[model samples]
Target: MSKIVLARVDSRLIHGQVVTKWLQQSAANEIIVVSDELEQDEFLQSIYLMAAPPGVEVIIKGTESVKAYWENEAAAKNSKVLFLVPDLTTLREMVEAGVVKEAIQVGGLGGGPSRKNVVKNINLSEDDVEILEGLLAKNMEVYFQAIPEETPVPIHKLIEKYKTL
Candidate 1:
């Protein structure tokens, strides 16, 4: 059966860090990017598909489609899947749909007017914090770590620091 070795949330979906570090670390042969917007753009979809390393397979699907895939075909394949979601909102929705049930790796969150920088490449809005906390409440291991080398900051620590900021 296919298994999701890594479930990560990164604003920049298929980037260098993902191709170089996380993919190798997770030992995932297939990348399943769950994004509603990206699924609609065939041009961008092609670009993302081409961005992956030669042997690795990349498939872009919308939230609902991914959930269905996980429930059906995903269980039959021998592939090790690397699940990627673009934002905390999508991450939360996927979890609620039962697509992602365990640990999460937060790589990058773009900075915005209402968002605060929680780490060098990580930013968080109020809603983002709430979504993460909700995941933690469900006993999900949520963490912020840029690469496999960087120390992973736990959800509780980030929430504690965000309150102080």
Candidate 2:
């Protein structure tokens, strides 16, 4: 059975921190990117593939395709699996689609005009917070941390701190 080592939602699909920090901490051999855009864009998929270290296979699958892939031989062969999406809504969708429940470790969510509610480094929109709340209600752990060793800031407490706004 494949174990979900890391479930992350980042605006930047993949980057240096993901390559060095997360890959090392999770000891993940394969990085599975679940995105509809990446699935259709062969060029972007190639870019992500080239960016990753040699021997670390990068599999790009559509968000809706995750469930089938999860039960496939390839996913079963891997010991460590990292699930990544661009936003919280995608994570919630994946969970709703029956991806195994696990704690979601949030990383860098880049700054933007609409994303004004900043907690630690993750900028949460109202919809993002709602998705997180849904996940938390499902008993899925949600927290923020740029790196694995950093202190985890729980999403629930942060939401409580700023829910009225």
Per-residue lDDT of candidate 2, residues 38-87 (tens digit): 89999999899998998787878887777788878555684687778887
- lDDT for position 56 in model 1: 96
Candidate 1, residue 129: the lDDT equals 89
Give lDDT per model, in order.
0.90, 0.79
Worst 10 residues of 2 by lDDT: 111-120
lDDT of 1 by residue, 1-165 (tens): 788899999999999999999999999999999999999999999999989999998989998888888888888788988999999999999989977876899989999988988778888899998998888889999988899998888977887888889
**TM of each candidate vs. truth:** 0.97, 0.90
RMSD (Å) of each candidate, 1 decimal: 0.9, 1.8
Clashing pairs in 2: none
For model 2, the superposed segments whose C-alpha errors exceed 4 Å read: none
Candidate 1 regions exceeding 4 Å error are none
